[model samples]
Target: MDSLHHDLTVVEQIEVSPPHATIGCKSLPLTFSDIAWFAFPDPVHTLFFYDHPITQTIFIETIVPTLKQSLSITLQHFFPFVGKLAIFPTSTRIPEIRYVEGDSVAVTFAESDLDFNYITGNHPRECHKFYHLIPLLGSTTKVSDYITIPVFAVQVTLFPNHGIFIGMTNHHNLCDASTRFCFLKAWTSIAQSGGSDEPFLANGTLPIYDRLLKYPKIDESFVKNANVETFDEEYKLPRLSGPTNEVRATFILTRTKINGLKKLVSTQLPTLAYVSSFTVACAYIWSCATKVEKDELAAFIFVIDGRSRLDPPIPAAYLGNCVMPCFTLARTTILKSKEGFVTAAKLIGQNLHKMLSDKDGIVKDIGSFEE
Candidate 1:
């Protein structure tokens, strides 16, 4: 199967219109919004499987028409922000990405004979993933508010075994992690619906970033208390006061266990926050790992999407990042407490809620800091 792996060829082609008359325009500077998207953890490309095979021909035939219709409608209604870096020639163009010669987008069809079990262990092998920057990864459509993002999928063969395997990749420019998932699910639904009533819009109206910027300003105070550096500088780098390596561990919490936690917290003195389950879980796990008492200081940093909080509507589905962080604090003593997990969760929840809606919340704090 290992040799078969290399045998799998990734067929690529771009679906786009004619190129610009000339090449190499001036370099486009990134806007505040553009930098906002870049600030997020660089999006990771994912590999997953489909229960059935839709031949690339069939998929292309089926998907293109629907996409054309949807893209037309989307551009008219929601001006998506695909960012500027990957646009063909110079970056300042209204549309961010374009297909020039020799560039191809990859698509796939499921094959039963190919190995589908390319999945290695609980997580897919990092080496198996493909990393490429879509030159127009997020270029908006030349036709206003719309943008065409290139998504790629490949089949893989692991070991000498021959069974069908599929892999998909997309440049992060067009969608944040959440938007990526939204697009995938939306694509599947649209495909299933034959493009009827595409469910691409977020439930609520998207907030307008231009106006919302007034509330949350950027500054040193907006910077994370944790060490700040370019992602390249942070790679394999230890946390400011922590070890060289950070390990990810997972656990499943059953409803029964959740009830037990609730019961335990009710019996404890301070009211534990019901909101911090995941945050508290992290604290507990970390505390156990270090074999230290619970009272030590730990921070829970997480994102809060501000779409609904904005004063005006922005294209909710615009293809870029629009997330802010909320940091929670927990003491080691709280973790060692009898209801440590629940306690941490409660405190985390409180802080998270306060960060989002408190009169003097993080947004306001950041705004003042920027001033």
Candidate 2:
């Protein structure tokens, strides 16, 4: 299985839009938070595997249509997923996601001969083996002074008699993890109801697009950092290439294990400002991953959701990035000591506490991030 070659056959490429004439042109401006990611070259890619034995004929006849129709319905409510990221040549004008009447998402249906269990297993596997299942976003197009970049794409791969794989690629400027999760929830609900969005409409929380966050100076700073003025027709999103030594594996911590780690941190550092499963997990991973010399500096950084940290507190369903990074730096000697895990946990916990309890608020020192 480790030596398995990539064997994928393209079934069809289809364009799916919201049900015809259901909505008009819609545009969403990039907030400072979104603008902060404008320079990030990597797009978010995700693969979902489901165990369901089915023949190729059944997959094409029923599964494909159901997913297609349900996705179309999902896009009607979550139009940003189908929109294009539009960036102008000047910092004075903010970038945006624009959805015209006929804008559609590229959805590819394919069949793969690769072993499903091997690819989905917990063991480390060649990263390129899964690359074929990930769909590529459409090429960028420039019109007038602004360039329009396709933001989202989907791929469905069928492994006959094994299972199905759903892969997605989306530009980070469009939204964050929470918003993406909400979109999936709506799509899954509609899918479960046979392509009807009525249930999702009645039960799910609609995305809030009211630009509730405003910090003009911060926006300007991020735009300047992104250097949008230099973007030209040759600009393109960075892409992933194959045939490398890179391997990816998944590591899961059960609830009991996480609890044990938490208890250990609490017992070791009784006065630590914060101690939780997430903090301990991060600390443990950091300590294990760092192999630097005793005196070298090591840093651990992660993002915190800022939806509730805002002055007015943006809605939980806000449709774009609302996260702030927390940085913890310490000498490798401390992290590699006998109490390495506990030391790492204390460093991360104290930094998290400081960020969450900042006297001036989370958005106060936005410019300091670049420093």
Candidate 3:
């Protein structure tokens, strides 16, 4: 028999209520920054065990207020624009399973455990996952300028066996991996400390949004008074399948690996930095495929993140998907050459820098076309 079994006895008297509001923020004329934090579609949940059988009534009473207070403080600073984006705050809800007399305890355990399994499913393109918390999938909400993503709560439950589970899910597109972790850590600390009168949230002084908003004519006019070109056909990527599937070949290079690659390159060029490693790798990949891809005249493309090199820091993190891709061109024969990788990487990096540095016609070109 479980030692905590008797302690799990049900109490009929005490009562608790759910938190009235959750932590979130609001903003407008939204951009990728607003959507990025919202895209982590996984649920975020946590579990705890109380020393005594926590009656449903008492459990809700003690937990709800704490959740509300903590979240309220965390959101005001971390995600100042979340509420403005979403009609409502994603929340804290305690979901419980009822059991009948003499039902096997093991059966109860299985059902409650489903929550944990749900949190680990998909890692979104944005690269954030709450493996520990289940995401509320396929839900949507509307806020301000954009549609609201289906908001989810980290569900908490106390079992008759004196164990508890909390689950969470969030989409990665909405927040960067780092920002997601920061929010989680802050939320967890608050939960553990009960409720504090003063929440240590970050003070947001960045006014990139305010400045952009000031130029309303330039802002709204750019998107509206523009000439829109219509492509004759929809563009789509070629799908790769079958025996030769796309395999992720991730290599974590140590300082040694980097140094060795540089040494090899320097034997000819006299000086080469490890930053060119990706270019080298790309060359190797292209050489292997040139015969096949070139025969078909297919285009090969690589993506770059153009940020910070702008005249002013473009609020890349806060601005969400504030990114553009630059391309490097080559013939099949060029890619097959031994020096292709270095040459390509150098050109890629240089092009990236040039794109960010060139401000004369960047936005203006597009606006003029649209107008």
Report the number of the highest-lDDT candidate: 2
Candidate 2 lDDT over 159-274, as tens digits, reads 99999999999999988888999999999999999999999989999999888777776777778889998877788788878978999898998999889999999988999978
Candidate 2, position 310, lDDT: 60
Query: Which residue segments of model 3 deviate by more than 4 Å?
Result: 1-25, 32-73, 79-148, 151-249, 264-307, 314-319, 356-371
Quote the lDDT for 78 in model 1. 22
The all-Cα superposition gives candidate 3 an RMSD in Å to the true structure of 12.8
Q: Tens digit of lDDT per residue, candidate 1, span 231-302?
A: 221132111222234432336667776566556555662554343445445545544543465446876676
lDDT assessment of candidate 2:
0.87
Q: Is candidate 2 or candidate 3 better by lDDT?
A: 2
Q: Count the backbone clashes (under 3 Å) in each candidate.
A: 28, 0, 52
Model 3: worst 10 consecutive residues (lDDT sum)? 102-111
Whole-model lDDT per candidate? 0.41, 0.87, 0.38
Where does model 1 exceed 4 Å of error? 1-8, 11-34, 37-41, 52-175, 195-250, 273-298, 310-319, 329-340, 362-371
Candidate 3 lDDT, 330-369, residue by residue in tens = 6766655677555555555455445545564122233343
Q: Please, what is the TM-score per model?
A: 0.54, 0.94, 0.46
Quick one: best TM-score, which candidate? 2
